[model samples]
Target: MSFSLRPQPARWFELLTAREDLTLAVETLARTGAVELETHSETATPLVLPDLRGRLEEYNRLAQHYQHYWPQDELRPSNLPGRPVDTFNHALQRLYAWRDAADAVVRRSEALRGELYELEMLREMLLAQGDTPLDLGLLAGAGPALAARLFVLPPRTHIAQIPAAILHTSVHGKVHDFLLAVGPPAEVDLLEQELTLHKGRPMHLPPWLQRGTDASLAALDQRTAAIQAEQRVLEQQLTALQEEHRLVEALGDIARLEWFLTHVEALPVSETFAWVTGWTSDLDGKVLQQALDRAQVRSLLRFPDPPRDKVPPMVFHNPWWAQPFELFARLLGTPARDEADPSRLLVFIVPLMFGYMFGDLGQGFVLLLAGLLLGRRVPTLRLLVPGGLASMLFGLLFGSVFSREDIIPPLWLHPLDQPLLVLAIPLLGGVLLLLLGLLLNGIEAYWRGALRDWLAMDAALLLIYLGGLGLLLTPYAALAALTGLFWYLGARLQRAGGDLRVLGGALGRLLEYTMQLIVNTLSFTRVGAFCLAHAGLSVAVVGLAEAGGHPLLSAIILLLGNGVIIILEGLVVSIQVTRLVLFEFFIRFLRGEGRRFQPLPAPPHKTERT
Candidate 1:
């Protein structure tokens, strides 16, 4: 499935001059080589060129303009040695400056109006208390009402008397009495004196006096309004400057990127490079040929030999659904050079198990809808749309609608209500999947020319699975057959290896195989457990909703219950499904550590005037 490419001598070429057309020719040849080549340039390091000075300037301007919209620290640039560093720094400075100025203007405008509003409110509060005269003689009376109103009162204190000149009111056990004995003119003077006495403390006064003090607050509001208008004009000017900054910054980036690509093409290098190399499978070969043919490449050098060691596979850019299939292909192990179709066994099984455990029609529909709607915005969720749809399909079979079985008639049986069926299906599925994994392992081992190891290792698993299935059907006969086969395989493998170490290794593998059977069979039980948990949780939600008396409260309960089930159960099921794939299935067949192949392509350039 894997190949290592060795570069042929004839394919190598060296460029004498650094002219643009010559650079383009060299790139065309490299692309046609149908292989990734390593090279060291004698000219200036192609990656390093002019700094993004223009981009940094524009970024700074934009940052300043939007400074108020974001946190101060967000606008700051990192000190890394790249275009990003300079660009972000410039943006941060500009944003912070503009943000600070705009914020200050807004603050000033608001502060003036806020002060005026508070002053006006205070005047209105005082006016509501009304005019009252101060009585100096009443302070000496020591009557219950006088004592309660003038100062502190003990618990259960009551106002016993009020003079004709005093108005008394009690609020929440606190008494207030305004003396009406003195005329308005004399009382105003006395009130001014009392206010001075309690400079920092709250003082009781007649409401009429408070109403007459709002002229200053009205004047303050007018000043604040003027300041706010001026601030808006400054903001408008800042916005215009920011747009110009962004356009300049974008231009600088494009220019810098073009410069890098142009420099890569102009390297004074030979077609043949002294470095490690490798070849890829037929699919990779075809893709490479197509890319080259599209570019109209000709007269190129290449090595037709398969790679000697493992090489990175070439990745083709495609839509999201296609990515999973591609990733699965890579995981299953490399295909033979001549093989056109890669194995897709894992793709079907992984999703099926995921849907089975997560089955709930209503929740599944929500997931499908949300996934479809959000997939364009977030590419990663595209997989979930198909996954959710699959779950809903299975859910329908199980008659599980929002975790309640009553909504639909079961085509088979409810997983929770029929515990035996639940346990049986996952175990059977596991047995079959494990066998498939072993079969794949054997096939890959055979292809790699490790027949003995394939028989001793992968074939041993097949025997265990078949023997286990047979035992489940007819215990005594299957047990007898499995015991004989296990011993026979063990002895044969031992004799095949003459070395003492090899025998010991073979024995160790036998023990490991026995342990794996016990563990893998038990792991499938999780599928049943999750199915029951989903049903139980949904029932609990329905019970709680029904218990509530009010319609609104019941509805709220139901909403919360469904939300919890969707988020919590959804995550747990997803993790469990992935675990089954990665550990149970992948461990048996997948060799996923190979690096991907990437070929050199044409460098981008802008035409220059003569």
Candidate 2:
């Protein structure tokens, strides 16, 4: 298991292959789940690539059109990367075949659906007439001599305009007036023009529906049932068609090949060959090399010293228990290849600080349970398990449970009882932690062969800080001045060009660093302050519970109070822990200059498929 203190390692490789074998080389490397190809921007790309890209563009458009039908799962490439033209053409052929078979059914289905909508609307208008006789033979367009029609007039239309000679009956609806009119053809036609002027719509039943209201409704229902049955039959036909053509799997193949071609198109190539370079995990590099030989690809692979020009990708190899702590370190970024990885350290540091601020046994168990229930879905909350365990440990020390102190005796003094000691302890711990940070920086500098430079600047800063802390606990008042003198000489000799003119500037820099050291050490006091706040909140909750009038009332208040403190204080304490760990601790040594490793994904394993 690679721990945080040890650097993650990678092996750099370069590959030279005949242009034709380039596809197989990529395939081998990719399928082995290794190799990040580096592009040489200076190398001239060959003509073959542009043609390949142009062809892939067509498949890309086709993919977009059918993208909704693609499987939700991962897609595996069905074609070798070398045959870019063939792969795209194959995808196009399958898509066109499916579209040919499916289009007719789709169009018919659409037309049938449109007809069904109109039939349903007509049925609804008939039903709304409600026990009133609907005689299509008597309505206008059906009557031979005297024309009769149902004119749905707008609510604001002038009814006085209806000719007194015409026979009419009216029914008022919420928004329109339905009027049945019988008159000479000429007069009814004139009335039609007037209703059209008022922006009113017309409703008419088919002539065949001249049967009484009950019989017309039955006929409408029978026709509706037939149309619905036909729609169901079309749906089944479409499903069978989709299955026979394997439309979804065709889409998956098309998508997979599209992804493959895009990745390989950026190679650094000459007229006849391509060069691929990248860093790989050592084991994967060996596997890729072996696979190339087995596949008889005309290629040469070499494991070379890491490139000086670019930062090699970093891969963290940590034990399972320490894995979750990676989230904290990643908040900043991957650690620089030469600097420290903070993940393992956080395993101890984060939970300790978190537990110190939120020391309660029952709440800790609640968090632990929550982590168990939800950790898989929400990865960040996985920290809750370790944090809760640490909180339980601290709860034992502070003698608190469910915001009550009477359940257990203190293994250590309660924060409220000796707030001074609570405040003082973290300060001392802070001194040690800050000292450790400096040491880690010194160690990193030494690893990089720059220890002398670190000693010149950071070493002086460290001594001055220690001397300042010494004044509080020991007889070392002059120690600060002596360290300040050392800083002056070191700065002048190392960075100031040995000029006396910059003396004030150097001294000012020292004073600035001195204040920073003091402030950074004091920042840990917030840890103790939050601890006291938690204890006080617990006291208030218990007090409220005691003041309640009835036993049930007290229980309710106590339960509710515990829940609020658990959620609200839990969030506050987590934020504090992240703040302290990130800004306070990590800034001491991490520069995050390394690149994260990204291996080419293998062809995804086939999901449910033909």
Worst 10 residues of 2 by lDDT: 601-610
Weakest ten-residue segment in model 1 by summed lDDT: 4-13
Best of the candidates, TM-score = 2
For all candidates, what are the clash counts? 29, 1
Q: Provide the lDDT at 464 for model 1.
A: 60
Give each model's whole-structure lDDT: 0.53, 0.75
Clashing pairs in 2: 140-148
Compose the digit string of candidate 1's lDDT tens values, residues 290-352.
Answer: 543454433232444433333335433333345554544454544432222222453467567
Q: Flag regions of model 1 displaced more than 4 Å.
A: 1-250, 253-255, 258-310, 314-322, 325-343, 476-508, 597-610
User: Residue-wise lDDT of candidate 2 within 250-344, one digit each (tens)?
Assistant: 55555555555667656676756778877787535668778788767778888877666667777776777788988777788887667888678
